[model samples]
Target: MSSSLLIALILLLSLLAYWLGCRRAVTLAQRPSADKLHSRPGYYGVLAGLWCGLPALLIVAVWHLAADPLLTRMAMHGVAAAKGVASPDQVDLLVNDMRNLVAGNVVAHEVDPLIQAAADQYVGLQRLGDLALAAVALATALGGAYVLLGRIRPALRARNQVERIVEIVLTLCSTFAVFVTVGIVLSVLFESIRFFQQIAPADFLFGLKWSPQMAIRADQAGSSGSFGAIPVLTGTFLISGIAMAIAVPLGLMSAIYLSEYAGPRFRAVVKPLLEILAGVPTVVYGFFAALVVAPAIRDLGGLAGLSVASESALAAGLVMGIMIIPFVSSLSDDVINAVPQSLRDGSYGLGATKSETIKLVVLPAALPGIVGSILLAVSRAIGETMIVVMAAGLAANLTFNPLQAVTTVTVQIVTLLVGDQEFDSPKTLAAFALGMLLFVVTLALNVAALYVVRKYREEYE
Candidate 1:
């Protein structure tokens, strides 16, 4: 069974068990002071449900995760040994084929008797596993309920115990979010460390070239690809520059108009209209960039006596800017609206025009938020992939010109990993290294933005 289906089945059964348990517990004996119970009957039902599902879910999760990989490995090893395969790597390929067969993903014409046998074995084990899981789960839930029932005497602090259990479960669930982030960061860090073992981290960070290709055939000497990230970062900055050029003025002005100038009726309409820019799918933006925006820019540049590549950084950046504008304006608009009414009145009372008061008082007061929003935009631009892939050229040209074709780290990472490349190859490793760089850059931007917002924020009236 799929993990999700397993979970759903377990939950459905647990809920049913909980209701039955709750009914049994409540009717076990009628208390004269039943109304004096610490919690309502529904809370008791929820408590029963929690006890039934939570521990069993935890046990199942731990067991499946720890054992599934081991089982798969043993199966692969057994199949390999049976096939008399000498190279472990060759065995792994056969194992993949076997898995595909079991999944029914392989075409019928290609299905051999060996593959069919493996698939049958896989399906058999899955059925046994499901049956075992169901029996164990039901038994555990009943056992827990029976024990809890005996303890639920009139004097027992059942509510307190249930609440404590809930607190622990909630804490564990929340910590998974932190764990996921740390896990990703650590994986990238370690892989990047491995990559740096092959190439100097300094060269990767600051060198002026970024051709990540390595030869596939064993004795073919060719141009050594430099890991200098200057071009990718240069292109990243160029794209960001063009995006910011498009986003900042437009977004900030929109915010100023929305917050300080627009009346309520206008605000109601314009805010969502501005935010609608954010709802457009990034892939749609990518298509627009490739089909419409890039060609228009090239033609426009040609008319203006400037050479423009059809897949220029400007087009992607501009489209990305449009994507980021809502992020900037919405955040800045909130901060602007949060400014003290008294300050605006004071500025106006000093014989300042509405424009002067807004420019001087409101904008400066909300400047920190604006800066944060801009930093967010910058990070978004750096990490953007689809638009750059479709619109920005693949050439890792270290050019400052927005009209020129250039590439970013995300685009390079995509090109490096896609297709049937060996995982141990430099081409694949380059992606991990680029990912580390991207992580560091975004991390720095986030930290700076948070610091700026915190430092300048008017926290109290």
Candidate 2:
């Protein structure tokens, strides 16, 4: 009676219900005195299937959601009453241990007889609950199918019911997505508020140094960490700027050539090959940046008598730019293709050359989309963690020199939260602050890009 097994059984029963309903509808249609069937046979089948499945799935979801807490409460109550464990915190700990033991996960505390008994009880309760759940779900599915099949007459409006169910499902999915996004933003915002309470917002935002190492013990020799974000933010923008510099020109030019000049066969073959770079894992790009690009940049810098760190911003930015080129080129190519041929035809009729037509007409029409693609590429570059971590050394130096080593905000976030961390500490909470900063920065970028797009779109219109 595992949940997956119950779901499969319910689906199978729904399929049977669909077949029966369709046959019933077909039989009704064949009657000499029956009016034309209200809807298609498929609609009748679908309506029956929905009736059979939806109630059973709802029961299954509610059962699982309520079962674990109820079982935990029942088990914990017995343990507390028998053992006189009155403290709330200790009860919580014991509950966790019992659940962990039941789940076969390692428990923090050594298992005692009381915990063992409670775990066994929890398992027994879970098994009994699963059995009940299976029985109820199956009966409900069968009952729903029977009711719906009996009601499936010529005027039943099966199609309308099915469409309504689908619309409700889609609305629920959209709402769930919005809630998840809001949840993420609120969680990060709350943690960042906690972090800012510990470290002054001014110091965190405007301080020059980026050290986040806080001494655990008062007597420890380490300096209390400086949460200055300036260096980190500088490095982020530096690398992202370099990446955009490389990505935009090359990606846009390649896109223009492919869309406007290249032959159909060449464009078809080369575009996929170009887009394959996007499909390659970021880690692979990281490795290539670290092994191949970094050394090459350093060697070239040496030949030019310039100082280049072994892991420099230039190397990471260059590789990141190459990795994101497909994001820009593929999207730009599509946007360019989407530009109506009438614009180009009008330009040609006005005696404009191909280059003039593209510059004045095609590109203007596609400007908004091109800007969107660049914005996406910029976001990709900003949020890239693996390539920056691999190629750029983790030094928060406030320098604009691409030859020097620097680190990004994403790298800092990952570094700060790498291991087990007490969330209350400013050191750990700093990760949330950095995340919030990134979120805000990206939002600002989107707003700016949108403004540019709207302005240009109005001009063209």
How good is model 1 by TM-score?
0.85
What is candidate 2's lDDT per residue for 1-461, written digit by digit as tens? 78899999999999999999999999999999999988998899999999999999999999888998999887766787687888999888888888889989974566778988889988999999999899999999999999999999998888899999999999999999999999999999999999999999999999999999887667777768999999999999999999999999999999999999999999989999999999999999999999999999989989999999999999999999999999999999999998888889999999999999999999988999899999989999999999999999899999999999999999999999998887877889999999999999999989988987888773322
TM-score of each: 0.85, 0.94
Flag regions of model 1 displaced more than 4 Å.
1-6, 13-35, 39-42, 70-87, 106-119, 142-163, 340-357
TM-score of candidate 2 on Cα atoms, chains taken together: 0.94
Each prediction's Cα lDDT score? 0.81, 0.93
Residue 458 shift from truth in candidate 1, angstroms = 2.4
Question: lDDT by residue for model 1 over 246-357, one digit each (tens)?
Answer: 8999999999888877899999998999899898989999999999999999999999999999899989999999999998899889988888999989998999999998
RMSD of 1: 3.6
